[model samples]
Target: MTSPRRFDDRTDAGERLGEALRDRDVDADIVLAIPRGGLPVGRAVADALGVPLDIVVASKIGAPGNPEYAIGAVAADGAVWRNERAFERGGVDEEYFQREREREAEKARQKAERYRSGRSEPDLSGKTVAVVDDGIATGSTVRACLAMLAATDAERIVLAVPVGPPETIAELREAVDDVVCLRTPSSFGGVGRFYDRFDQVSDADAMSYLKTDP
Candidate 1:
């Protein structure tokens, strides 16, 4: 039989995750969560650490007919990172990839503005910012977020997540100051499969998390 699924909810899991980070001595100036699902976890981290919580909106450009398979991801300001293997696997050519990227870039830009909603992004200059996410599966979106963070002059950029497979975590480590991942289960299938209630996080929900200042 399969082992019992872990975590009760995002908050409970996040609190446990926050405690783990504290134990590991992972501290930061602020906790920036990739919007929607990440917001709930980021809220717990920020609250546990007594820091502000913010959202960094990013979008994944997935291969057609395989929405879960990310070929690339786009963040605000038009930065993107493509997975060559994904392109090859998806049978996407350079011309098609470029065209798709431009389309997704615009979507990312629009999504970012919607998430920001006139809220000013905190200046990362001289600040140690912690980038939090609910989890990582493909790492494409996380890479995009890291790319955006890199553009800022943050003194330190930390990637924190409740869970991720080992391979993806390893690939992501090179992009940030430090990665604080709590769980890397061998049976990792997807982020949603690990969550008890992995519902779709709407833009309104994302904005609510930001508006709550959690």
Candidate 2:
């Protein structure tokens, strides 16, 4: 078993986690990171593992009045993570959900274009893929990503993150072949709370990481 992760920055966290994963397994073809914040961490992982890295862009559909409240989230290719509990709690109808999905789907497409335009998505058929992220919060977005990757004919999929809530990590275990999170705190409030310098990753920084030869 690997030791718990503690780092000064995302690059440090990614390098440490990547080394752990590389020491355990050596058959990953592509390390796909969920853009904006995930890119830098992914770059470090890709560099350490000597693997190709790419983006898996997705966006969440927040409720109208409660913008932070997620009803559903969609990937670039329309894979949806419907929160049934949120529907029950928020009292959202199908029409509202559908409309929000459409809006978020468009945003996802635009973001995908910004992240990876002109470049075709990497072919995952019969290849192992490591999905990297800075961290996971409620896990809605990662679930959407797992669903999207499930449509492809990949040999295996690994979901790797720096940290997440214990319940979210448990929920993710059933979604991917392996879950590689170093920290699953019981009192996890948010991803940013764990990092020392967790700043909002800008589009330029994100795109730069994507373009880097990691």
Candidate 3:
């Protein structure tokens, strides 16, 4: 049997998340969504908050033989978030981790450039930026993205998501200025479990959301 869902879809979740942010009185200067699932959610959030939407790219560095298991993540700007426990469990060495980080960082950079389509990188200096994603699982990529943002001159960085596990959300709280997660289920199996319509978002469709006027 399928699990009960809290959201009809990504857009629905995003709308609800936006409302939550408004209730918190978060005055964000921009919304940066993690593609490709984050764009739809970010679109709704940007529209609701009357701000411009953009993309922040990150790629997961998986375990050596298990590509599905993320041992770490790297951002477009080369900032990295290493899962030390995963590394120890997987027996991943510095050489392998460094190699994967470099490779994945390049891929992330290319993806960001493609999504931007010649637009220069936004100046986040002294701005209140909200980072949105569909949800958080292990939060590897989100951590890497947050690490990148932390290195910037931005005054505040907020992480907004539709849902996440209680433990993950608690840990993420320390990484950002504020968090605006709508749901933090203790029995979470996965991010898709809380969504009735969790579909894979294509690059083209995701990019279209960025073009939407907020």
Candidate 4:
């Protein structure tokens, strides 16, 4: 088995990703992170690129009995990405999916509202946007986010992550204009395994990063 490259933490991973984006000359107008884990990484990327920091909220639609197994995901604006194969494999019907989609979409909307704290949503009309995430696991959430972005008038959309499995990254490529993944190891496990300090970030701590004062 191949050894996975480890990052000191989300901040370290973000720095590496930011450097990669800069090296590739990725010009972005705004950095929308998927919190609460993505905030630290987003802060680093936004600072490096001199862009405003924001968030793109989404929620997973887990399997009927197994909440951890994501069958799909829903975004704040009701955009969705359904894993047809997983849904078929889990024998999930359209009725159940519709119910969960509405529930999860509302949750995503509320989360986005809370994160924005009364700020108006950014106008992505004819601008390049980067959606930042700590890493990709199943990619259900990120896929949903990309779908939401697709509905906007944004000129381009980029999905940026520190690490993700090669296959999943390949699948994601079809959903966005560009993908900036720092590492795609062959012998992939969970995202936490590649990080030395993968602690659960608190909402308060995550919100602090959104502040402009530093």
In angstroms, the error of model 3 at 17 is 0.6
Model 4 residue runs over 4 Å out of place are 1-5
Candidate 2 displacement at residue 153 in angstroms: 0.9
- What's the TM-score of each model vs. the native? 0.91, 0.95, 0.96, 0.95
Which has the better TM-score: candidate 1, or candidate 2? 2
- Top lDDT hit: 3
In order, candidate lDDTs are 0.81, 0.85, 0.92, 0.90
lDDT of 4 by residue, 1-214 (tens): 1224688999988888888889878899999999899999999999888899999999999888888988889999999999899866757889999999999999999999898888889999999898999989889999999999999999999888998899999999998989999888877798888899999999888988898723
| lDDT of model number 3 | 0.92
Better of 2 and 3 by lDDT: 3
Best by TM-score: 3
> Taking the tens digit of each residue's C-alpha lDDT, what string does model 2 give over 64-152?
68879777789988999998898777578899888888888888888888778578788999999999999999888888888999999
lDDT of 3 by residue, 3-48 (tens): 2348999999888888888989999999999999999999999989
Per-residue lDDT of model 1, residues 93-180, tens digit only: 6787677778877887787778778777788898999898888988888898899889988999989888899888888989988888
With candidate 2 superimposed using the best TM-score fit, by how many Å does residue 189's alpha carbon deviate from the native?
Answer: 1.5
- Could you tell me which residue pairs clash in candidate 1? none
Q: Looking at candidate 3, what is the lDDT of residue 159? A: 98
Candidates sorted by lDDT, best first: 3, 4, 2, 1
